[model samples]
Target: MAPQRVVPLSLRKPTHAVCVVGVEMLVDVHSDVPRGARSFEVAGSSGLEVIVFYDPERAREPTGRFRWPLHAGADVVVSVDRASKDVNDLKVKVSYFGEPESQALGHGVLYLTGVDISLDVDRDRTGQVKRSRGDKKTWHWGPEGYGAILLVNCDRDSLMSRDRDFANSQLGSLADLQDMSPMVLSCHGPDELFDSHKLVLKVPSSDSKRVGVFCARGGNALSDYKQVLGPHNLSYKVERQSGEQEIRFYVEGLTYPDADFSGLVTLSISLVDAGSLPEVSLFTDSVVFRVAPWIMTPNTQPPMDLYVCSVVDINGSNGKFLDDMSYLAMKANCKLIICPRIENRNDRWIQDEMEFGYIEAPHKSFPVVFDSPRNRGLKEFPFKKILGPDFGYVTREILLSGASSLDSFGNLDVSPPVTVGSKEYPLGRILFGSSFPNSGGRRMAKVVRNFLYAQRVQAPVELYSDWLSVGHVDEFLSFVPTSDKKGFRLLLASPRACLKLFQEKREAGYGEAAQFEGLDRVAKRSINEMLADTSLQSDSLYVQKCIDWNREVLKRELGLTEGDIIDVPQLFSLKGPYADAFFPDMVNMVVLGKYLGIPKPYGPIIDGRCCLEEEVRSLLEPLGLHCIFIDDYLFYHELLGEIHCGTNVRRKPFPFKWWHMVP
Candidate 1:
């Protein structure tokens, strides 16, 4: 083939050579130059340099190089003018070239911005995460283990743009590329990871090179990353970092093991690039994880295991009462621990100097005794420290005395503690009556609540009428354990039931009015006197209100139905004054495990019935609880005391330990 003649540059169109720099390189082209010109020079904008190279051996190679000004994602246009004679200027177009696409090779640099790690212990039950600087390498967890959260923030520009498929694939491939990835996080120790055969955690992802194993030096790997996140159900999303694209990593779960896991553990975290040729890697300081010792408060449960009461030998008043209580304690198969009288003086001093009410044995103090787990003997059981308000009395024996507080003539501020519970939670609540300033007021209630909470005891306060002669909760209500499905039922005083019985008896022409006709004037006069007293009327109103309030409280708070309540019939009466008057009381009974000690209802005969003992038994027998009617009127009830006032019971502890359950 014949060679084509070379055209003269000055006679034909002007040729151009373009070089683009400072931006990405996309294309390069060089055309053959005309043979007539020895050398050519091109000129353009400032801050640019052009170099021309001439080599005789390589005739086709471009002889010139130029540095041009370029912006990211913007096109660059070059105008080449012919310095030779008689030639026109030619315009050459250059493509745009910005930063690279690879995350490690992009214009933005990857940096470890902020790291947040939190440790939570279950013993405190606060669910608070303690922030750590991660300077320390060792951490401690409670016996029930703990929960944690780790946050890793990366520079925004280092992250790829949003592409669901690409992101998912990268996350899916993480396991395979973990060895080459930049960061590794893990926990190491016995049972370090929950429910996994291998203690190490292998976070699965599409791009293992992007996210690798995260660990602390002494820590073990997290078990089942997916399972650990099962509770939180975490999700990922793309975000901006410093005005640039970013990807966030959020991992939360229960990381520590149970009490069985103890000793030192290392949590190591490291970062390194796994790109074609990586040059950067980072490692975080290790943290410590320690398992603390298990501790818990011992609370009291019910079903009386031991009976505690003081024996008073003053004026021989409580001798028969003591005998009856002892016999009842023996019948119930409970250990009777009799506390001696607070006054150890002679009988004359006790009878003459001390008030008759002060001789009441159980009035001295409210003893809450707890036995240690290692102790099995009842005699060695020690009393818990006084938790409630302190009464200004000489001896600690009057700590919870109900004498001054209950008497209407004295004060109604100090409330006597009454422990009660339901079938769902036996002996779980310590019930207290509302107090006035004269009694132990709201301050006492606050102190009691705070004390119970501090001691890990759960209790609730209930409202009761202070207008009654004896403003004690035990005067109107009691709790008895039953063999029924409900486990326990509330015993309440019902004047309506007594009135109904009296009316029915009268309709049959054998009521109290008809049987005891001679005592009618006395009863009628007493009723008139009670109605005349404004304080008594106020007391009646308060008593009705208290009954209504308690009914609702029992139903709502204790989860009790009408069937779970047993109403005992009794009528109100006035003897002398409001303080000295005595009303027919029945709910002031004692609970001895499966036995119910009730007062023998001694009053005028009605429908051939002189006493309601048989009726009371009939009403309670169906509930699967036995009843024992004792004559407490002579020594106890008549003297302004009830069965509970003369006795107390020390209960057994619940079987399950508190530490075993989740906080």
Candidate 2:
């Protein structure tokens, strides 16, 4: 914002006073004025009232000559009744000591028009308060966007309490102040000038429900800093005691933007002329703030924490898988959190229960757990354990529309940072699987989709997922990091690619080689036996078509070419009308930076090596990724899931701020 123009003030004794038109305010320096000017007198015309402040006694007018050689007295302040129009309608004159020589020189009159006041904030949205110049009321977008940002106090701040900070009317602890955004109020002038005027901060009644404000009084105790403006409190009187010039305030968002709240809340400060009959506002300054939205991290982001559950039942136990995950986490340089059987309640599908996300602001940020409405054994796990200090939790229940297999968060996915056409998604775009439009079979709950769209940063796209029995987006596709212009590669499950690998082996004289060579309780098939099964071939072809449809959708939406995608060798078997993975799905892997935890496929062994694993390593290892295959067939695959379905990951947020985007 630009700075307000300064009007010149010059009035002295034994000479003429310089007259400056469009003068707003004037102040008298006791040292600058000579003792010859015993005192000064102020008077205004019909439309104006000249109010002067020379003494501390109840803001009286200039009934007598205000003292000039004020011994240790405050500077004199003069203000006019109203702002001057194009024509200087209300002329004000001030004469210093009517001496005989001054009579020959005529009256040394000081003309005054108006005493205007101004308020300013971080109008440029650079986290610094500046002087108001242009467009302080309207907010704009783009990289050159102008406005402030506010963070939702939705995270727990105090260790003693689990309640979200915004819910508590009073602050829980002093540390709670860190979650709020900062605002500065500057009213700099002679201290005595405020005796005839007052500064008032105001918020629209509608905005009170969305924000709460607190002042930082110069005291150590919590009681010294009180909430000055909030619910039911629309205006606050700024108490600038004595020589105080600047005041600091903290603002907290009470709720996220939704159907009711537009997410844009504005606060204004006004200067009121109290000496007037009705007291009028001379000037008002307004600045806007937008509430931050929750954003989900894609696979390309480096993993910070790994989450998995341990369960023991009649089917099997995940003891071996847990050990493998611990080792992988160590290699990836991340912390591993294991959910015990007591906490998991035999629910190992943690990815289906919730998705990890976060809300951010310039001042503070925190991770948030988005709980799905699946309501399984791990339904309350996130709320009970993860909703702690600096970690937030949010959820939406499918009340009228009952939950389905597609309601699981495993169907939720987001591509790596992509640029489609001329537009770009620096935080990546959200991708979720659902039934075909008008199919009426099953889809993710509408309420969940509404919440995601309200976020606004990541645009969500729908894909066909009901073609499979356990329909999930992770079962067929994922993304991994690579050092290229695209920064990542989309890993897609391909039955055609798996078939080609087997055909090459058969032609190389490995026709008798058997899948699951040593594994028991599971049927084994020779390369020639699998090649002769026409029914299996037809099923694989149908699943390939389904995956191809999503492949096209992804390429179009993510602006990807065939070079940016890598096909993982895997097949599926038709079960009734839907399909399931023929082997442990290799594409559904846990990506942690350069380390990838892939599900081990018990394929035919040739030259003492699993061909499927060798093929996957060849495709991914060249891109600087480690493919660590684990034996998940016994527990996870048999239960109709893979590593990605059972495990969850919390990755680092994007470095690019969300407010910079035009959307």
Best by lDDT: 2
- How many angstroms is residue 443 displaced in model 1 relative to the true structure, after the best TM-score fit? 7.3
Residue lDDT tens for model 2, 89-114: 44555455535234222123434334
Count of clashes, each model: 58, 0
For model 1, how does the per-residue alpha-carbon lDDT over 185-241 read when each residue is reduced to its tens digit? 222212211121111222223212222222122212322121211222221211112
Query: Candidate 2 — which pairs collide?
Result: none
lDDT of every model, 2 decimals:
0.35, 0.78
Worst 10 residues of 1 by lDDT: 354-363
